[model samples]
Target: MPRWTHYGSVEELMSNPLQHLCDISKKAQQHSITQNGMEEAMDYLHKLHIGDTLVTSTWKTLFAAYRAELAKLFNRIGVTLDITSNELPFGRQDLTTPIHSEILTHFLSTSEDRLDLSSSNLGTPRLHRTVASPKPLLVDLTSTLSNLKTYSRVIRIAPEKQQFTYAQHNHIVSKILSSRPTPTLLPKMETLLIAPVTDLTPLDGVLSLHTIFDQSKQHMLKFARDPNADEDTSKSETFDPVETADKLGVNAITFQILQSKRNKLLKFEWKRVMSDVRDPGVFVSYLYARLCGCVLFLSSSLSMI
Candidate 1:
């Protein structure tokens, strides 16, 4: 059995008030259906001329994961799904369908009247779909700061990734850039990167974003080197997570040692990291650009004076 409204179509229902026929589906009214009933409903659903828009009843938490997959499947096939709340603690019945401007106005007005009536009793106010539990101020602040740091770091490091491979690099750059209308312009290389940023342990894990970016660069480089590399060989070349973690740990230790002795050991500064060898010039420029800028600036000042 399917839920039927007094209005024939979604458009007509949206234009008019919500009027569901109580007798059509007992399960729909109750917001819980048996497995057999669900199968039958799905069969009936497939038979109907479903278009771009779809509406679905939310299932129990036990079926939540599968229900989400079902929603995704609908989306993949170009259907826009409107999910209604589940049975026990019932949610808004009227908002089961996507609300239009008129429907929104009606709901708001109805809520206002309810609030006005409930005002006499301060113990409980009219709770509605529009209201949500207040989030903790600390939680919100921490989340904002974390996101800001991660995104800021990503933006700062984007140019380095961009210099590696144009196509793949642009994909990452575009995603980070699109988060805001205007992005903070990274200062000239001369001002930044004055010190060797040898300690870059990702905030997340061993397989951090920088590692992923480097992996993509290496992948692009491999394709450039041997365009005829078989798909099988390419698949075989995939880095093992455990092995990568081990190597990253080793690199971190080695970088620490090198950074400590960089002033005394000029040759070590020129030496490239074993993990990455392509375009050592970029690292050298990043590590020493500020020194070059300082020397040039001092020389110019002396010459001008």
Candidate 2:
């Protein structure tokens, strides 16, 4: 527009309201920045969401109320409140970087009072595989944490894996049951037997020895007489399909056994077996026989394949 109508006058007219709005906006921006910084720091300390700003903002007021209540109780009990000190009895300390470093160094010291590494088997080579009770420990820890709402964030740092196999799990349960003095009850023991249908390898031989201990009634009798014998030795002589199936508690084992059979079949050398076969009919018959033998060896089915 022509003549740019009195720019100084226009600025003067809007100055008061504009300045007020500008001041409000600046204050709001600063508040937002401070709130965000506080939230970030809190999250770092607690390792979990602290919830809404409205809720969190009231915590300081709530804490003050609690402190006042405690002070009143102390006064009623004839204990004088320290008016000079604003700090609570168990208040968190404000430490400098160097102080924090020193505290951490003291905590991590290898001295006996700070850290103890001695154990009966500390230097011994581990002969058996060690299965940790991480899941049970986590469950116990979770139970303890459930009592404290603020400490619920610690669950995220716990281990997820149980680290024990089915047999090991059963053994642990049995051990726990045996250790209990009251009621004098014994836990039902079960065994897992995994056998390959192929020729006996060294591992298979070892497993055969295990099976002898697990399945032989004579060995079980010997174990009963000799307390020093393997505790895992089973009392049964023959594998009773009905009783065994009932104890198994899972139908998935059947599927697993079938899958194992399929794997063996897939790995079988067809060329090696059928190389001498000249006739297609004879080859088919021979393959059928081999498959039947494998099926019998792998499964308990008595029907003709």
- List TM-score per model, in order: 0.17, 0.15
User: Against the true structure, candidate 1 has what lDDT?
Assistant: 0.26
User: Model 2: per-residue lDDT, tens digit, 1-305?
Assistant: 21212222222212221122222223334566354443333333122111111112222332222233223223322233232222211112322333222322432333332211222211222211223432222122223332332310000101211122434333322332333233211322222222221122223212222112123223223323443234553344332332222122111122223333223221222233233343223222222222211221112211001
Give lDDT tens digits, candidate 1, residues 129-191. Answer: 112554322233223332221221111111111122223222322322233222231121111
- How much is 141 displaced in model 2, in angstroms? 14
Pairs of residues at least 3 apart in sequence or in different chains that clash in candidate 1 = none
| Residue 15 CA displacement from its true place in model 2, Å | 56
lDDT against the true structure, per candidate, is 0.26, 0.25
Predicted structure with the largest lDDT when compared to the true one? 1
Lowest summed lDDT window (length 10), candidate 2: 151-160
